[model samples]
Target: MLISRFELSVARRQLLHNRGQTLLTLGVVATSVTLIVFLATLIGGLQRRIIGDTTSMIPHVVVSAPERLPLAPWELPSATAPAAPLFVGRVVKLEQRLRKIEDWPAVVARLRELMPGGVAARVAVAEGQGVVSRESNRKPVTLVGAVPAEFTRVVDLQSNLAAGRYLGLNGGEAVIGYKLAADLNLRLGDRVRVLSSEAVSADFLVAGIVDTGIAVIDRSSLFLNLKDAQSLLNLGSAVTRIGLRLDDVFDASRQRERLEQYLPYEINDWMRDNQRVLSGIRAQNDSSRMIIVFTVLASGLAVASIMVMSVTRKIQEIGILKAIGAKSRQILVIFALQGLAVCAAGAALGCAVGWVLCDALGRIEVVVSATGRTAQLFPVANEPFYYGLAAGLAVVSGVLASLYPAWSASRVDPIHVIRGQ
Candidate 1:
């Protein structure tokens, strides 16, 4: 039976009789709601840190060669032709396409042409995988090639340098990420051999060390002069990618498209390259939404249990009411409303508690390792609206829990209790 005015009044009276039980159930529901919100906030903060770190180190737009199935796994011969052993990059001559966008060449030259006189273009070579050998241990490393001075113009590589000096364009030296250096037991004066798939091997003196704190980069990356990498790869004047630096980094996608038209070869921006990371983060967020649902259901259980016990204790009262001409449907309405009242109260309390806890947590400071930046961690302004969602979940659970008990209460045989049988 549906709830009625008289039944609603009775449900209210029953809840009023047990103040402590009502509050306790509210507390549990609210706690669970707060926990889920807090977790979501933490995850969001971590993602922001990763994006900030990545953008600071790499350009918003990074142009690379046309997509090709990378060289064969078992064939060293695939890296370079015999006569040009050591140069390992794909090249395309575009004399008619690029270098014509007004001042593109002057402002956006390759590494060799990049001068400190305000030019912003730079070329880079990237060897995806290699072994950094030291003593009896060999650790994997990502070897990058760039003209150090020119590269820093596009990427903030200088700020990350923790020790020594930048490798000169003409020098056969390399700069290693702090984590990679630590693993291979390298120091400023140490020398390591870089063997490419092209079978053109070369040794570079460790000139510097840098700590970016980003585990992905710090633990695996090493930088050498672009000329050195090109020499080893057998590319005399070619590079794997051309990285562009600009004033408004956020407008990279537009610039990337423009550059693609200007060049004969292919190019890719940062977002395209890091799509997997973005997708994973979004998926995790979608899954976290269920946390609030479970909390509300648990709260509903408390309301159900309380209503059931109340009905048993008031069986005689119920019989008296029935004997006085109250309908079975009336009794059912009264009990159902009581369940609704309990849920409503709990939902209100849960929402309040969620807001208080979330606000308090936001004032707390946390250091995220991914970006090496400390932040006051908390949900943004619209975060409290999520509490509404949690409360709704609890209300649904409460209604369902109350249903069985309300039905059983409605079927109570009045004559047996009223006549004292």
Candidate 2:
């Protein structure tokens, strides 16, 4: 007990004697640790935001018919054949293999049963290409026919509306993208002519104009009632694809593969399709880690330098302590305690600094280029694990940096020092 008290007392005295140096050392450690934590929080928040935006905009898994079809060489010209049409050959009308999901309600029910609570939503969509024309102006638009009630379960398209309501699938009603509306010079109640590939044309009232923040979706997409779309596209009671939002998007690819064994369809998972975006996120994480590593080294070096100088100045005191009956181990413990004390104080202040910085950063608006929108307020991840990690790193650096100086102080010779040599 006495030895412990004496070591602590000596450590306190040394720290107090060099108050300016002690504060400087603490400031260095605190600054580095604050930066480490701030970077971590910023990265974590951005990752979550990106993932949320991606998953919300696109389905985690999409089950659809295989787009490619095997062609008969006898009916069609071979690749090596002349580019000119075979005028002598029998004329055949070009037809798209337009596969559709049959008995879709039953399929969705069966999938829900198979996965239990793992699926969040399953929406059926009928997709096709069509031309929207107003007077002389005409542009191709991608048509997505959906049951508003079910589609909302997968994507909250209603919430992103810039004008009017979502498609209720009522007679002759459709919702258009913002860019599409602008191209057609349309308003909430305006009527536009939609021409299908089958030469069928219909005039529909513009129910809503949506700005999804995704430029591609906003520029060329339109939504209408499924039954109306089927009639217009000459597809009878069939859907082109089924979109699924899972409880855990990370497991989407694996679950999609498993579903493909029983379901005769192609499955597209977001993670597999968006590898480029994910790769960019990973590169950012690597950069944040590198920054943290350098900051830790800087803190360690600062502590080491301060401890070394302190030991040099206290060499005579160390020799007297040994002569008076303090053991080498006691002297080592004193210096080690000083390092611990400095780290403890710095960590407390660093946490406060990090919190303030993180809050300030979170208030700033960040422009999301991919979405063509600004995030009004940035987010910060306040997970407990980050604080624990920062504290652990600081403590580790402090101990390692103090070791050599403490050892050197403990090895001081009392006889040589007292003899005035």
Give one digit per residue, the lDDT tens place, for model 2 in 39-156.
7887888888788778776778898876655444555657656575445555454476456786777777877876787788888888888898888989898888888887877876
lDDT of the structure predicted as candidate 1: 0.66
Best by lDDT: 2
Give the TM-score of each candidate: 0.50, 0.80
**What's the residue-level lDDT of 6 in candidate 1?**
70
* C-alpha-based local distance difference test score of model 2: 0.82
Residue 132's lDDT in candidate 1: 67
Worst 10 residues of 2 by lDDT: 85-94
What C-alpha lDDT values do all the predictions have? 0.66, 0.82
